[model samples]
Target chain A: MEQHMSEIVTAAFIVIGDEILSGRTKDKNIGHIADILTSVGVDLKEVRIVSDDEDAIIDAVNALRARYTYVFTSGGIGPTHDDITADSISKAFDLPCEHDVAAIELLRDYYKGRDIEFNEARQRMARMPKGATHIANPISIAPGFRIGNVHVMAGVPSIFRAMLDNVLPTLETGAKLISTTTPCPFGEGIISTPLGQIQKDNPEAIIGSYPKLAESGNFMTDIVVRARSEEVLERTTGAVRALVARLLTEQDTGQ
Target chain B: MEQHMSEIVTAAFIVIGDEILSGRTKDKNIGHIADILTSVGVDLKEVRIVSDDEDAIIDAVNALRARYTYVFTSGGIGPTHDDITADSISKAFDLPCEHDVAAIELLRDYYKGRDIEFNEARQRMARMPKGATHIANPISIAPGFRIGNVHVMAGVPSIFRAMLDNVLPTLETGAKLISTTTPCPFGEGIISTPLGQIQKDNPEAIIGSYPKLAESGNFMTDIVVRARSEEVLERTTGAVRALVARLLTEQDTGQ
Candidate 1:
């Protein structure tokens, strides 16, 4: 596998369903995709959860696909009357869409061994946009599809996740990640100034401060530092360590 | 609590962070809010994850807060340079934002017990928009604020979650939930026609079909039915169950 340089590879996720919009179903695809992208060094940037509205879907797809390197969509691909992802994507990209021969073949093969019927409803799963590639679904025969930069998968957590794992390895990957965190008992304000200075001093490393409220009713902050290269990250971490120690002492003696 | 008999109580979530846009962090707050809102009968209709850019934040805030009954935002309330939620909210609502006396008092009380300095950096947490009420943060002293209908919470999962729980009970809830699902071995297309009929027959119920690719490499679908009233939900579920049985028989015998 070839690795891209230290540049960041960004991705956006679009989740479609009236069930999620109505708050009837809690979406599980975002977290799963986030973790998977993180592990593979692909940054899972923005996520949009929209209803099965065609206008909303088309707008989000066009916007995100233009901004991010890759866009992944889950849900709205079923055989139901509301599964309008195929038509929406085609409309978004201005491509003709219809039931594809390969997808139908896959569905037929899977249903041949099962006690299920290969009916018109089942045939609905075979619909694909013109010139799209099918994403293999090891769990189900209704395969996900990838058109352009958008990878459309199922809404069911199990099926969506499996399809994600299959599709991720094929994408361009950045360098392995290294991260470290230091807890500061002081509030975010005390650390903000020095944190800015540290970032200014070490431009190569990516530094983030997360203010956390502990269960013990105490406010604490976590300063997370990440980098693609180990040496650069270590240098930045050293600077942060020194700054934290000095700040802690200054904070202690009322100086 | 007062119960409203509206058709739906809709909400939108705005997530503000450069980290999320850069893909450095996978957001957990959206899912947390989705689950909480669902349980409380608020329909979380849309979610927008935007970069910490001020214009983007303001634009999203204006658009979503106007359309939805409620808007909840997470992230950009820290002490760092990027912590700009309070300022943005002020701009969006055209309110003069400054450090609130009550928030300062809370911070003073919170930090008095800790061995850290209550310096300018920590003091940033006290800022709030004019006419905004503080949302309790049991996890940290840096309280989130509610301006108009927009509830601003910390981005950290634990803190955001704690703040949301505190605010949920105070909102006017619509109705408790009732839901049921029927598993169908056929694909979504076969079920779409009957699903439409079921939905039409039960206009009070929200019927949805989720396509699942089974682990046995077979396609299966879940037809979910939900309603605000248990009586209606049960009726819809019975109709769905009967429809599934009839459809399966019809497909099996090639009718």
Candidate 2:
């Protein structure tokens, strides 16, 4: 494993849509982006799902962009009246939004031969914040944009993925987080005490126990150990393995 | 269908777990809770997903609780070292968490002769912040709690649903939102111009367009108009239905 990093690059996702809040649409973009960010060594610290309301978008974009190293937004950049993310983003940064020539050119080329006309609505996709750089969208001709730390993209999963592929390579990478998972066919109650001790001993690593209810009405916990440092990761994972093993052995001999 | 004169209630959800951030688990609670909240007249304003980190939970809780009328938290109320949401939430309110006699009694009665022992770890579920009232859990004997406007519930979907059923009846209900979704065969680009005009004409209603790209590589947009007042909802939906009819007629005649 590589040596632990000096700083862990963190990111926040602002999912912009009204369909999501209305529960009409199940969000497919968050987990997709989270997987991409994790594989590229960026810690996705927070995610917020907000409606298409302009004030809500402005508030969330400003808050997340200021806090995390990168702020990735999904949805609301399409060519519709309700698609107001780009304008709201401009409001967040207190800048004017205008039609960009590069984006307009891409749209014109894509729509020249297509059924969807390059009308004012499709032209709306070319509107981006002033002084913002475009994030390429191969899936859709309409380009996403990057202003400051925020990367604004389309709501559709394919377009969001394409934009991410374009933006990920340009950002700085951090030390990758390493993890090990062990299934504990035991109740969380049985391991809480010793698990707390393990947590105390390995402060650098994050230990999490997730409890799932079984068919027979028992708690099944999966313990995961995560750390940026290899030594810490191994040591903590070793300790967790030993503890679960000991408990298993004890139950085998007695119960 | 009632007059929209009163205030609109809002809620923000904090989903606590490492599984979500790791992309190992697809979240089921957000949509479930969003649906429930919307049904009960409360607007689900935002949702944040955070890991089991203490500072992250604390910060999210504080921010959401302050911004929205209610803050609902799911996860981390189990019997393990990683189940630290109860403690973290207590810290958010600057209160000490202790096992409530009511919860302990309920658990004790339920587990008196059960296979899983009612041990110290199980006792951990009884812990709640000072001056908090317990929210009953029907699936499990353990209960969730409410401190101020923050409602702390289980991470498990079944348990979370049960707790929500108990909590919903106690909350103040607002005017239910009315919605009508119009399936527009025309592309979003084709309708974007007039849709903006319709949006302006119906400022009381929220107009949303969700475009679905088909296997045939065509854009299908579902436009939803939502409002609290029945009159406004009807008027806005009528305008949308008329506009879509006009567009469809134009396409049929190739005008």
Top lDDT hit: 2
TM-score of each model, in listed order: 0.85, 0.94
- Per-residue alpha-carbon lDDT of candidate 1 for residues B114-220, written as tens digits (9 for 90 to 100): 65667787788888899899999876668999999999998888888889988887787667566787888865656787787788889998788876656554456
Instruction: Please report how far candidate 1 places residue A154 from its true position, in Å.
Output: 1.9
For residues A1-255, could you state the per-residue lDDT of candidate 2 as single tens digits?
A: 232377788899999887888788889988888888788788888899988889989888888888889899999888888888889999999999999989999898888756445778888899999999999887667899999999998888888888889898788878988889989877677888899899999999988887778887767778889898899999999999999999988753110
lDDT of 1 by residue, A56-106 (tens): 899899989998989999998877767889999999999998899999988
CA error at residue B169 for candidate 1, angstroms: 5.2
In angstroms, the error of model 1 at B214 is 6.0
DockQ comparisons of all candidates to the true complex: 0.45, 0.59
Write down the DockQ of candidate 2: 0.59
| Model 2 lDDT, residue B32, Cα | 92
Docking class of 1: acceptable
